[model samples]
Every structure is written in structure tokens, then in C-alpha cells.
Target: MSHGWSIARRLFLAHALFILVLAAFVGTASFVDARDRGYSETADRMLAVATAIADNPLVLEASRGADPSGSLQPYALRVAADADLDFITIMDTDRTRWTHPTTSEIGKEYIGAVGPALAGEPLTEVSTGTLGPSVRAVVPVTDEQGAVRALVAVGVTTSNVTIALNARLPAVLGLALALLAAGSIATWLLGRYLRRVTLGWGPEQLAQLFVYLDSVLHSVREGLVLVDPRGELVLYNDQAARLLGIPPRSPAGAAAGGAPLLADLDLPASLGELLQSGRPARDEIHPTGSRVLVVSQQPALASAAGRGKPAAMGSVATIRDHTDLQSLGNELQGMRTLSDALRAQTHEHSNRLHVLVSLMELGRIPEALEFATRDLELSQQLTDELVTSVDEPVIGALLMGKAAQAHELGIALTVEASGSLSDSGLLVQDLVTVLGNLMDNALDAAVSGEAPRTVDLRVSSTADALVIEVADSGPGVAAEAEEDVFRPGFSTKDPGAYGRGLGLALVRQTVARLGGSLVIGRHQGAVFTVTIPTHRSPEPTPAADQAQAPRA
Candidate 1:
């Protein structure tokens, strides 16, 4: 839905209205005050002139003459003309006008109030007379004995007062318009600034964008967390809170001040360090309690314009749960190993059958029987040894499969099992990950060596623990490189291949998860030994493992 006015337009209109109203109020007040002042000043000036005319000795003597108008009227007219006054009236104590602006009004009764003047007091007021409404003043003309013998009144018309007020109106209006113009310019500039900040987006658009961002954050399966440069959490989606074991009741910005929520949750130390580092990192696998999480981190940076260095704002991290996927991959690898073993056995039997048929066709019955007996005895003996040495079917099958694979590669492989294995506290997947990787590494090294390449495998279990050791007649590991051999991504093999060095790393991880240990033995060839505790309580079966195993 759209509103007729955008936020910027609304702001501008509101500001302009406020400024206009203020200007109008100030202009009206100034005009009214100036008008009142003009009237008062005009009245005072006329009063001063009236008092001066009434005090003159010549006017006083003339006022007491047998014809007061004949002597005083001329003098009053001359004084009024010089002072720019509309009228000047000289009247007796009887209130008869002796002089007026018009000759016809001479000797007539004054048409305006003279009560104060008759009482010997000077006064100023706005009054209407024969002439018109005027601002007028009245003063008494006293005799030698201080008696009021006559009166003089001076007045200026209301039109003259209005003219004086109009003279000052332009200044007031100009000031008011100037103020309004300044306010409008300021409002326009402010509106432009707001437009830049909002990137021209209206209120409706911004609100819709917020809604979309919120939906995306909530719907994503991978956990995402954002932290500020100070190592305080800024944003955490529902998935992140659940994955990190944080309570859902925590409010936003609650962690911004101080990350009490992060402190309460069981996060790995490496992850906590990454959040605090304010640096970019990628694909770091961390183990948090029972879950394995692959986490990637990116730092937020400010614009690099002109500045020598970019400013670090914060960091964002995404976490993915890899436990289930890793389990499935291990199972698939085990199935492939079993299939390769079956293929090797089939090929071996087919070749022997071809030889036996040739011998029978040549009519060599004794030679055919001897060849068949020798092949059957050798295969049966190896099978019986493996079954007797390893009581667990999974381990027996794995050994048999690896032995056949070794034979196909023309590498002599030997298995020496000194003790029995129980399946009570052992996981077949963990066993395959450990034993399969070690044997595969040994086979690779054995095949790459000179003639007479051989690999030795040993398995023994005490009442407390199970131990396995594998050694190959290949180039031994350097003393300095032995520790780094098990580190993930550290490979001496084909450098072009990705995930080549992860086999030993996965083996080490599995060993650590099961509370076991792996070490390199001091021998002529690369010898790896793994020991796992058997007396402890069994580890819980993973949900993925409980599903159908991978088919061979």
C-alpha cells in the first residue's frame, strides 16, 4: 500500500507550516506594536505644541482682549500650519472656539471634549470632532493669578496616524518573508539529507525490506550469528540460539552490552576466540560438547574510501552440523572397501578355474587335482586364521577384504591378531574409520616402494583396551614431519587432489571421540599404533548410524 506523501515530503511540509505560522505571529505583533507607538508619539507631539502656544504671553494678553478671535485666531492658524497639525483651537472658559482650521468654524463651540482643559489640566486622547476622528491634546491657557482664562487644543487626523504606521509596515513584512525563506531553505536541505540516508526508499519500502530480511533469517537451516567488534553478540537467529544452546528468552541487544548469553552457552574455545579476533576465517571445524560444527567467519568492514586502513566493525559466523554427514561418508567408504574385496576374490577364482579347465582338457587329471587342492587349502587356511583371531564379524570381514586388495596390488599383506575383540562397547563405523584409513595409507606406501613391498597389520586386546598397529616396508616418515602427518590438509601425496590428507585426520578424530589415542612408533617404516579403551561405558549410537547401512 502507498501513502500519498513520502516521509521526506511530510517532514518538509510540517517544518514549513511551523515556520510560516511563527513568522505570521511575529509580523502581526510587530505591526500592532508599531502602530500603537506611532499613535502615541503623534499625540505627544501635538500636546507639546498646544502647551507651547497656550503659554505665550502674546496669546494670553490677546485672549483677554475685547475680541479674542481677532487677536488669537491668526496666531493659532500660523502655529498649526507650522507644526503640521490639522487643527488648533483657542477657546474661552465658556468653551467657544476662537480659532479653527476652517474660517467658517471660527467663534463656534468646540466640537470635541475639553473637560480636562476647563479644569486646568492638560490631556491627550483620540476623539471625533467636526473635522474627523483624530488623536488630539488639550492644554489650558492660565492668567497671571494662575486661573484658566482660555484653552488651546491641537489634533492630528486618524488618517495621518495610519499613514505613519504604513511607513513602517514594509520593514516588518520584509523581515517576516526573510525568516520564512530561510526556514524553507533549511527544510529543503534537511529533506535532501534524509533522502540520501534512506537511499530514496520510502517508509513502505523500508518496512517491507525489514520483513523480508526477518523471514530469511528465521527460515535458513544453517545457524548464523553476528557479533560486534567488542565481542558482544549483535544478531542471532532462532537456529543459532538452538544450535548454541542459548535460551530463547534472551532479548536483542541484551548481548550487545555484554554477552552473558554466550557465557552461559557451551561453546568451544576456538569458536569464542574466532568471534573475538575480529578477523576473517573459513571452514574451521570445532567440537562443541557432543556436536561437530564446521564454522566459517567473515569480518564486517567499513568503506575504504580515502582512508589508509579499513575500519573493523564486527564479524558474522555460519555454523553447519557435520556429524551426521561424516557418519554416512564413513559407512559408504566401508561398503566400497567390501565391494573391492569381493571383486578381487571373484577375479582370483575365475583365473584359477581357467587353469583347471585347461589342465582337464589336456587330460592331465593328476595335475588338475593337485592345482585345485593347493588353491583351496591356501584360501581356507587364511580364512580360518582370520576368523579365529578376530571374533567380531565386522573386523574379520574387513581384514579378509584388505588382504585380498593387497594381493591384487602385488603387495604382500600380513595380519597378526593375538587376542579376541568384543562388540559390546565398540562401534563398527569407528573401527572401520580407524582401521580402513591406516591400512589404506599403508597399502599406498607399500605399493609405491621398490620390489618386495610388504605391509604388516597387528591386532591385540587386553581386558582393559584394544590395540592395533600397522607397519609398511616404505620410506619412513621424517622425524620433523611425523607430528604434522595426522594434521588435516597436510599431505605428501598428490598435491592436486583435494581431501587427500583428511583420512588420517578423520581417523584421529574418531579415536579422540571414543576416548582413544594414536601415536607413531619408532620403526624402520611408517608405523601407526592406535589404542582404544574397552572397559568404559559404550558411546551412544548416532541417529544416522541407526538407519540402514550403505549397500555393498
Candidate 2:
């Protein structure tokens, strides 16, 4: 439970202990086995010595004579010395000794089992005699008739067997030490690697950190993404995938070693380029498809243990959906524009009333009436045109407001719309986004252009698609910049201009979301034509609807 020792240290110590225990077991077993083998080999050697002495002719000849000790005793002592045996004895069938290494024991009864030896089968065993505990063998000597004549016994002491076993201890010990040394070295190397990777964190600490990170990744409302230095998407939560229009994490993406690369994903050019640059950005707004996002990114840094400075790892980005906020902001701007238009109309009406009052005072009532009638007719006609042309109320109101604003700015705004936009199969918000952005850009372009500043807007709905075009009598876009004009942060205006690029981008994004196309043309000025499919190119199926539904 203590955090003092890291995971690597604990594992290394465990392995070292295991190796030590194993070596001890092996060495002990080897020593025991050697001891056993030594005793058995000593018994075998004693047996062979006894058999050879028993078959000796000199011993056989002396066995029949009255003075057998004369030939046997000297020969037994010589054999014992030559064979390095503790003792050798020549005895009679009745268990009486004829010769012994201890000359005093001649003619004495042997102190061991001799019944089987007397019956002619040789026997080997461990027994205690005058020379102490020893492994001994006994054999019977036979004459010409194959009858038992005399017996020969030989033995080597247990102490000498132990000494032989001790001789092999060095080799067993050496092998065990070699095994332990090799194992320790390997464990040390593995520990060092683990320490570097884990940064010396214990198992419990790592587990807690993992749990915390997983919880934060899933719980946060904002989309979080991590990309490696190689531009491989290292990690992304469900929100990130959803916001980025990517497939949810599947088994393929979850594979430990198969993270998807950034280049493989269909990301917005602006977003992709930003991520690839690995530059830190704060609260940069970008549009992807129909959604507006506020993105912030920072360089991810990691420090090695004992290293002074952190190294650049990759990048971490957080994305928040700004579509709702952007929509609200646009709505506010439209309201402000209407308010401004209303204020201008009120001020002009007050001025006209003052003129009428002055004319009445001067008795010029008919001229005043004619002037008021002309102004009313002009406003009424424009209102009637907007009401009859645009079917959607929100879009109609938006155009009316934009037209009013354009008029106040000395820009002639003309609207030519026919047929109902009810069947456009596009959301009113999408239509508003597209039309509003185009109108605003057209107004700006016209106001900044030559003498006859004019903006023309045309809207129509057909069986297959709905078409909307806005043309400004301003400097048209250059041919080389046609493709990049709709990209976020691209503008033909001053480089230091702020909030001047996103209008076109939003227009393009809304069009794309509705399965629409936008075309740029030059007809006396910049022309923006948007075409949206009326009935959604391929209608959504019940299965697709179900798939898109949120789970409980």
C-alpha cells in the first residue's frame, strides 16, 4: 500500500527473490543427489573388491589349510591399502573371521549379517563394525565342488562418501550463482525501462490518473482532441467525433496501435490546416459545414524524469459549438438594423410633418399633400413587393430590413423574387443564414464601390431546386481568389480588418449543409449564386432516422 516503492522496483525485487529461492533449491537438491550417488557408488566398489578377493587362488588354497590366516591376512591388508577401503576381512562360513585389517580380530566372529553370504549369494549393506559405520559387501569363496569354502568382506566408511559429495559442491554453487546473476541483470534492465515510461509512478497512482482522465474526457461538454506529432489522432471523445462530423469510436479506432490519421479524416480545410500547423490558438472561430465552432489549442508538453525542460509532445485542442450563439448574435444584429431603419424612417416622417406644418402655415397645403403622397407610395410599393415575393415571413422580414439599411446607406437595393420558398425543403434558419450573409456582403461591397452603387437580389424556386443570387456593383473578386473567397479568414478587404471574413464562410457552410451549391461569377460586379435542392436529394430512410436518434 505504501507509495515509496514504484512498480518497477517492486517487480524487480520480486524477481530477484524468486531467483534466489530457485537457486537455493537447485543447489540443495544437487548436494543431496550427489550424497546419495556417492553412497551407492561406494557400495558397488566394495562389492566388486569382495568378489575379486573371494575368487583368489591363494585365498582358496589357504582356506582348506589349517593356517589360512598366513595367506589371507597379509593379502587382505594389501588389498585394503590398494583399493583405499577402510577395511577388508576374510571369514569362515560359520561367521568366524579368518583374517582382518585389525589383526587382533582374526578368528573372531564378524559383526554383520552373514547368513545370505554363507548361502553363496553375495550381499551389500551398510553396517557398523570395529571401523565404524560403512557400506560393506560380503561374498562366499567356493572350492572345486562349488561348495562354500571361505568368505570375503570389504567396506568403505560413510565419512569418505561424504567427502566425495563435498567435492562437487563448487560446481553446483557456480551454476546457481550464474543463473541468479543473469536473472538479476535482466530484471534490472526491464525495471529501468518501466521507470522511464511510468515516470516512477506506482500502480495505484497510475490507475487513479487513468480513471480521472477518462472521466474528464467523457464528462466535459466541450470536444477534446489529442493529436500526435505524426498527425495521427491519438485520442478523441464522443463529443469531438460528433462535432467534427466523424464516425463514433468503433472497434477499429479503439485498436491499441491503429489510431486514425488526421489526413484521412474529412475535416474542414481551415481546421485541418490549423491542426497541422501545431500553432497555439485561443478562441478562434471557424465554420465547418453548418456549425460554427470556437476552437482553442495548446502545445502538449511532456517532461522526462530528471529532465529540466519539458519537450513538445504534440497538440491538444478543445472545441465548443458556437452555432447557437452565432445565430443569436445574427438575430440581434438584424433587430438592431430594423431598429435603426425604423429610427431613420421616424426621423424622416417627423421632418415631413414639420414641412407640412410649415406649408400649412404658409397656405401651401396642396404641394405638401403631393410630397407626402409620393413618399408613402414609394415605401408602400417596396413593402408590397417583399410581401408578395417571399413566402417565408422570417426571410421576407430579413430582406426588408436589409433593403431599408441599404437605402439609408445610399445603395439601391432591388429584390426580384417569384414562386413560394415553402417547398425549398430547407430550414428557415439555413435560408436566413445564406440570404442574410449574402445581402450584408453585397451591401458592404456596394457602399464601398463607384458612383452607381447598387445591389440586386433574385430569389426563385423550381421543381428541383431553389435559386438565390446577390450581385454587388462593387469591385469584383479576382479570378485567382475565386476558390478561396469562401474559406474562413479569407477576405479581399484590408488585411487588418476584423470580422470581415466569416460572413462568406457561413454562407458557404449553410449552403453545403442543405445539399446546395454556391457559384461565383462576375457580371459588372461580384455575383454570388446559391442553389439548394428543393426535396433533399436522397430522402432520409426510416433506418437512417432511427440510427440518428439519441439513445436513452
Candidate 3:
């Protein structure tokens, strides 16, 4: 908003002023040189005319005769007219004029210097005489014995010299004008180029914009990255460096020359590929190392007010950490799974009570009692088995809740857990995250599959490692999509389905964080296996198997 004089306009004005001053200086110097040369030429010509007249034999004879002006006056007039001289004077050494351009002054004392001529030296100077200021020359005539006899003075007036200098003025002025025009044109072209590059912004405006942008990049909560059209990493802020697990750049590294290339960055495959493709993405989720990030990208462009349409400058991407958010979402999902299971159980218990009350009223107490006993035994068996198996109560509760949920949905879920996982050298939250997501995926798969829907879960902790496997009776992942299943935002379900692809991505991230490996294989259904190395050794225990019967 701080509008100021544009660089183009400023440069144009400055250069134009410079050209004007230069032209004035050059023109003045040229005019002065021409005037001086004109005066010098005039003086030289006057000196030649004066010396020629003094050397004339007719002049000597006329001057020596009784009547000097009788012949000299006509002769002086003829020579002055022929030589373009302003005036001619014939005088004696006593400063008495014999002949003159003005005939009235004839035989009068000369109005100008005659001593130099009497001394027998030819003298040339600019002097004010009866005819006005002129470049004049005076020379003396000598006899055969070298005694001075007479004098001749010849000059061209200052007016005539000025006229001659003016005659050459057009050429000098024309050359100066041509140089000034050339300079102006060149300045205009340079100004135009500067305008295009700077987008007509002044230096101060550009500097202010840069300062604001730099502050935003550093102060904003989200990570920001800028890539050039050639896939080079042109800029990245501190948050971006931290999220991407790269070294932070120095302050001076904000410059393009100091920034690293995209290929040189140790980025996750999905993110690296996305940046390299220069594709626009909105709120995309990606997993890198132990962290999950939500990223958005768009193509950057330069203004189109120049020579052509807007051009692709590069791409700008923003990143926000999603790891904590994903963890919280997983916890909420676990709670929802437990809530659904409780609701189903409550519904079943209420139905059973209604049946019992109806039977009692109909006097069929034995059948009601038998049904109740069988239901209690089945529920009690599952609870006892899980309690004996999973040492971590949180994990046990999660598995139990999932089993109950599956039973209500008419899917048989079997869980086999062995060896104490309490000493598995993994955080309880991490363990729950890994197992909960896998079970959720399994249950969802089984519930949507063909008749006799079933899911199998196996968890075992050894002296060196902990392993978990979940197999579901559903359509397995496609061979082509096997690698993509773990990528964020990839799903076998409808693309528009809410929260479709994030579950498996979180599972993969957790497993990797625990330094585990997950393998996908097919038997009657899809089987997912995870193995995480551990340094702790736990006491061996008999395997416990708990199975939930499908609802009848």
C-alpha cells in the first residue's frame, strides 16, 4: 500500500535530466570554440590583407607622390570589397590617415594605434576603432633602405566574425541533438525493462514486501515451503525443516543460491514425489518417519501484466503436524467402538429379559432358566479367558469391546493372545494404537463380507520380539494397490467416505515408530502381520484363546 514513484519513472526522469545537462554543456563548449576560431581566422586574414597592401609597389608610389589618396583611396576600396574586409586605412607613421573606408576621415589622424607600425612590426588585435570593434592588423611599408614610409591597417568587424561563427552552428547543434536523442531512447528502453522485471514497484516497496513475507514465514505456526518450477527447493522455513527432519537453515540461507535442491532433502517418498510432480493438493495427509502431516500445495505464478500470460513460478506448500491429532482421533474411535458394543449388549440383555418374563407368565420357567444359564456361561467364559491372557487391562478391554461389537454384527471374532505383553518394551498407548486400528479394520472387513463372516486376531510376545496378526474374511487388497494401502488418503472404500484412509496410515506409522515390520498375505482372507523388536524378556505363559459366537 505504500505507493511511491516507480523505478521506471524515476530512472526516466533522472536520465533525461542528465542528458539535458550534458547537451547544454557540450553545446556551450562547442559555441565558444567556434567563436574563438572565427576570431582567430579573421585576425589572420586581416593580417595577410594588411601585409599585402603594405608590400604593394603602387601603394609606395602613391604614398610618395604628391597626391596619396588620389590612387590609394580607390585601391583600398577595391581590395576591401574583394577580400571581404570590413575596412581599410592608409596612414602615415605620424598617425595621419591618407585613405580610409570612410572617405571623410581621409588625411585625418588615425583613430587607432600606429606606434607598432612605425616600429616596423606588423600587429594584429581586436580593438575599438572609428568603424567599431574589429580584429585589425597594422603593418608599415619600408623603403629600399628599410626606413618606414607608410602604414596599412585592415580588419573585419566583430559582427562579421559572429556571422561566420553562426554559419557553422547548425552542424554542431545537430550533432548534439542527435547524441541527446540517442541517450534518451536508450534510457527509455532500460526503464521499460526495469518496469517489467520489477512490476513497477519501487525499491522501498519491494524491500518492505520482502520483510513482511520473511516475518510471516518464520512467525506462522504452519510449515511453509517453496519450490521452483524446476523442482528445486527454493525456500523453506524453520517449522518446515523441523517437520521434515532436516537441518535448520541459517538466516542468510533464505537466498535462492543458498537453498538446497528438492532431491537433496531427505523427505518421505510420498511427499517427495508430490513436490516433484508440482501437483496441487488440499489438506493431504502424509506419514513421514514417526510423524504425520497434513499438507496443502498450490502452483505459484508471476503477474501477467508483462509481455505474456501469467507464468508458472513454482509451487507453495504448507504443512501442519497431524500426529497428535491422529492419535486423539484413534482414541475417540476406540471409545466409539466401546460405546457401540455396550449399546448392543444392553439391547440383547433387554430382549433376553423380555423373553424370560413372557416365558414366566406362560409357566415355562425351565426353558427361560436354561437360556439364561447358557448365556451367562458363554459371556463368563470370554471374560475369564481375556482376563487370564492380556495383562494390560486397557488392551484387554479394547479386545473385549471389539469382540462384543463383532458378535452383535453377526461376525465371529477369535482372539489368541500369548506371553505377557506388559514387559514388551513398548508404550501401552502405542501398543493399543497398533492393535486397535488393525482390529477395527478387521471387524469392518468381516462385517461387510459374505456369510459366516469371521475375523482372527493373534498377539504373541517372545523374549526378543512382539508379533500381532489379524486375518479377516473379506476381499483382500489388490496386488497393484498393496503398496498404496499404507499411504494416507488411499482407501478401498468410496473416495467420498469420511475418514476412509487414515486408519491404516496411522497403523503403519505406529508400527514404524516401534521399529516394527508389517507384512500382508492372503489365506482364505487378508492377513496383516506386525513384528516389533524388544529388548525385554517376559515370563512364558500358556496361550489363551477367546472366541465370540455370531449372534443367532
- Give the best candidate by TM-score: 2
Poorest 10 consecutive residues of model 3 by lDDT? 542-551
Q: Is candidate 1 or candidate 3 better by TM-score?
A: 3
- Give the CA lDDT, 0 to 100, for residue 415 in model 1: 83
TM-score of each: 0.65, 0.82, 0.74
For model 1, give the 10-residue run with minimal summed lDDT: 248-257
Cα lDDT tens digits, model 3, 1-552, are 235988888998899889988988998898999888888888888889899899999988887889888889889999999998889998877878888888788878887777778988999888998889889999999999999999999998898888888899998899789879988999999898888878998989888888888888889999998888888777888999899888877446666376677788888888998887778999888888888898999998786365667788889999999888877887888889899989999998999899989989999999989989999998899898877778988899888888888988899888888887888778888888889888888887887788789999899998888999999998877788888888788876775564678778888888887788999999777899999997784444544222343445
| Per-structure clash totals for the candidates | 0, 0, 0
On the 0 to 100 scale, the lDDT of residue 301 in model 2 is 84
Per-residue alpha-carbon lDDT of candidate 1 for residues 1-552, written as tens digits (9 for 90 to 100): 246455677778889999999899989999999998998899889889989988899879988789888878788778888888899988888878888889888877887778888888999999999889999999999988899989989999999899989999999999899999999999999887776556556788777876786777788999888888766677777888877778642343453455644454567666677767856877776555445577889987654333457666788899888768766766676677778878998888899999999999999999999999999999999899877878889888888888888888898888888755764367777787789889988988888777788999898877688899999987877889886777655777873354467678778877887898999875657899999987645545786576657767
Off by over 4 Å in 1: 1-6, 9-170, 197-199, 220-237, 240-322, 355-552
Which of candidates 1 and 3 reaches a greater lDDT?
Answer: 3
lDDT of each: 0.81, 0.86, 0.86
In candidate 3, clashing pairs total 0
Candidate 2 displacement at residue 27 in angstroms = 2.0
Report per-prediction Cα RMSD to one decimal: 8.4, 6.9, 8.2
TM-score of 3: 0.74
